[model samples]
Target: MIHAGVYYTPGSLKARFCLAGNQATKTFCDQNNICYDTCGKMLVATSELEMTRMRALWERTAANGLEREWLSAAELREREPNIIGLGGIFVPSSGIVRYRDIATAMANRFQAKGGEIIYHADVSALTEHAAGVIIRTSRGQEIETATLIGCAGLMADRLVKMLGVDPGFIICPFRGEYFRLAPEHNRIVNHLIYPIPDPAMPFLGVHLTRMIDGSVTVGPNAVLALKREGYRKRDISFADTLEILRSPGIRRVLQNHLLSGLNEMKNSLCKSGYLRRVQKYCPSLTANDLQPWPAGVRAQAVSPDGKLIDDFLFVATPRSIHTCNAPSPAATSAIPIGAHIVSKVQALRESQINPGRTLRAARSVDVLHAAFTR
Candidate 1:
């Protein structure tokens, strides 16, 4: 889903990038002939408490300079009869597209520009020197590069550690489980329906979404996963589980969010429990309406003190830059994120070449520009 930058704090990287990315993604889609839906989004409030939160969210959207409209309960019903709510905030710029299509298009473009993507090259080690960095893969292949940008999603922290850098955080996997509504209920809603999220929590509450394929999807409840790649309940890696358990940060996280974590686990196990969460706003849905859909695991970064890193985080060495934490909206903000990384890489390269030169000075000399052009 392409976010409209409604929920992010103003002046943060998320807000800046997401807003820019919303437009960039659409432009890219247009240029690539990729189909997408600017179906919009509604944050529905089911209770007075939620309504209050909804108002705060509305103010936040304004602060973020997003295009939004306040929807009265009657207006909300008029727009989406299937959704029940006290009130809602409609964001017109929110949209949906097949991210896989975008990724594939990007890969094709990269290859067309003489870039190579080696599949199944599991990086085993990284050795950095004054000249460059040497990367060794599990398949016994070694590649040396003048600069390395590590965007390993789940293994970001590990990549930093492989470079002999202390990441100061660990990656905790959170499984977001979804269920596709029955085809018969495809017209359940006209737009993506979201709940007024709790400000304290990072995960947005389970809500209904209108997919680009003309199907409605419900869910994406965040549950702590035992394995980094664990999508199924039974999929557990002993090493992953052991590592998670051993983390002082995760233990602190469990201690703080024990009740909420247990509630998520309960909802995951009990279909009825999960149903109840969405039923508050989408009362028409029942167990029979839900069908299995593929689940996705989020790579959430947590600090040593158990604080969930809610912003885009990057760690830099003289020769490398590691994207340590970037969760939701990262995909939506991919274009700007990539540009941001490129700028960082340029600055790092310049600093290495001329120790006393600032980025502005180096850019004036066109040192990195010459290197790239060469």
Candidate 2:
């Protein structure tokens, strides 16, 4: 995932963790001889209002310790003559790498460091014991651990509920529908190209991404998925649909964001509307150049008050720490985020060992638990 820089608030967990994650990823890639490019990214503004907003974006990047350079219309044209812009922000620190490969490398490193990962072992249930965490898998095998840390992406909220914690949100899957440009048009964009997002929304707006493989991918229109794991249209599971509709949090979120959500839903169905989003910046892209590509589902945590959780949220009970909401830029920030989680769990473990001396620390754990219920 591209670290778009502005989705996270300054000094927030998402911001710090993502900045750290970006640095860690680069170090890992360099050490492992992985191919990556620090080609940077440009957020182009075509209108007068958007140009004014570009200053705020620049300030945000600087506050986050990211290196960014602003470009005038003439300068932007010099950088990419084919692209048109009234103003823009050029982020030098932004870049690209293959996430699947990074996951593989991380898995290997985790195993080498004595971290065990059992594949295909879907967790069926979780029971907290006095001594440790007892995890029951679908295969009927029970495993015990001194402490449990859950990074279960899509199933996070359900896992929290299974542990008897009342998470105030529900996991709603939003599928990102993407299309790849044909080989002939691959040279159209030499770097990442983006449009200034709506100031009121959480989404970064549709943008162009240059993959490490030298292919260009456009779009990723957000649409509510019929299934949590749905990769294509019409892929639905009754249980998944029921789980969403049954949740009061999700219902309220939908009720509140109905207008914006309906627009996304419309784009999902109307190819013409979807294409218009692309045509806004890249006038040269025609519907014929858009081709099917593998899609990814984003597990968004929706609150009962109709708000989407945009930052990283964590909940800790005596037995486990649940990551309820980790959206886009998560993959970019996973390394530091993982380290942060490990630190929290370690701190909790230390408190458990010396409850008398670490009374305050113990209380902090309880606070986390209470937060989960609230």
Candidate 3:
């Protein structure tokens, strides 16, 4: 991401946007001079059985100050001329931004503030002691820090293991493949189009998104990957593959979602099967209109009990704090997450910095941890 610059156009918007952290994300956009669409609309296309649940979501959030409305079938078509669906929840505050640009901007600012940016410095080991935290990089370089935080995405679990902290969660990579709409079809969706996510499934079925480039991209059906860093359909790692198959975590996930797993695999193999998901709501799209787009791999954290970790989980030591699981919305909450970590670091008494706080087990859903006061 630090190397790729051109790919960061028209920021990344996904299935849905939340009223939470919307402001912080926008703040990032403004600071970077990144152009973004604020009045972002994301449509949650629903199945017949999902209407009740969708209605509750709208009811719960509508009163929170943002414009939330239950659009009727007629209303959906009337408002979005290209959409064809029964109806869904409409969130007007949802939006999209160039995430890479935001990251680059943050890096530039960090450097300006006396922060060093080191490229290709993959950490091979981390050790905490009275002297501080010692980091050994893969390039055979050693660096020590007064404090260290781990935000490694796909490799977070492995890195935490090096520091010898385990929260009973393992990261399982699920590759999401997306297809671009031909320029002719780009005008089809004016807002973000999302399928009502199944409560039982870890991944939302395929959805449509309006990128900042005035292009529409569809798909991102979740499929198990053979490697954690593998972004392509065929990219595989023998070691990572073996590790995943042998893990109790992956086994439990497979046992619980056998049919769902197979269906996702099918969607990945057959283009028609994948297209049918998009067709469910956007009937106007045809196979010919689909083009190639880069796919994303999500580092989904799963516990030994077959449940996906839906919330961000953190583990802390005296000299270190590790973000074991942070994916989607993590990008949205980058500012606050950084601030929260800094606050915690600042509050640490020099004497207590070694043992720090015991990492209690808690489900971190939407909110950041309370202010870490001295």
Query: Quick one: best TM-score, which candidate?
Result: 1
Q: State every prediction's TM-score relative to the real structure.
A: 0.95, 0.92, 0.88
Q: For model 3, which pairs clash?
A: 10-212, 11-97, 11-98
191-220 per-residue lDDT for model 1 (tens digits): 999999988777899988888889988889
- Residue lDDT tens for model 2, 242-309: 98888887887777668878998898888778888877667788888888789888889887776788
Quote model 3's TM-score: 0.88
Q: Give one digit per residue, the lDDT tens place, for model 3 in 1-374.
A: 01101111122211122223567677667766888785455455547777765665565454444566678888988877877777876776677777877878878888999999889888889887755789999999999987788788999888877877675788999999999999988778777777776667776578788888888888788889998988998899999999888889889898899998899899888888889888888888888888889989899888888788765666666667777776666676565566566755564444365455543323333334355221
What are the Cα lDDT values of the candidates? 0.88, 0.78, 0.71
Give the least accurate 10-residue stretch of model 3, judged by summed lDDT. 1-10
Candidate 1: stretches off by over 4 Å: 357-374
Candidate 2: segments with Cα more than 4 A from true spot:
2-4, 357-374
Span of ten consecutive residues with least summed lDDT in model 2: 365-374
**lDDT of residue 372 for candidate 3:** 24
Candidate numbers, best lDDT first, in rank order = 1, 2, 3
For each candidate, how many residue pairs have backbone atoms clashing (under 3 Å)?
Answer: 0, 0, 3
- Candidate 1 — which pairs collide? none
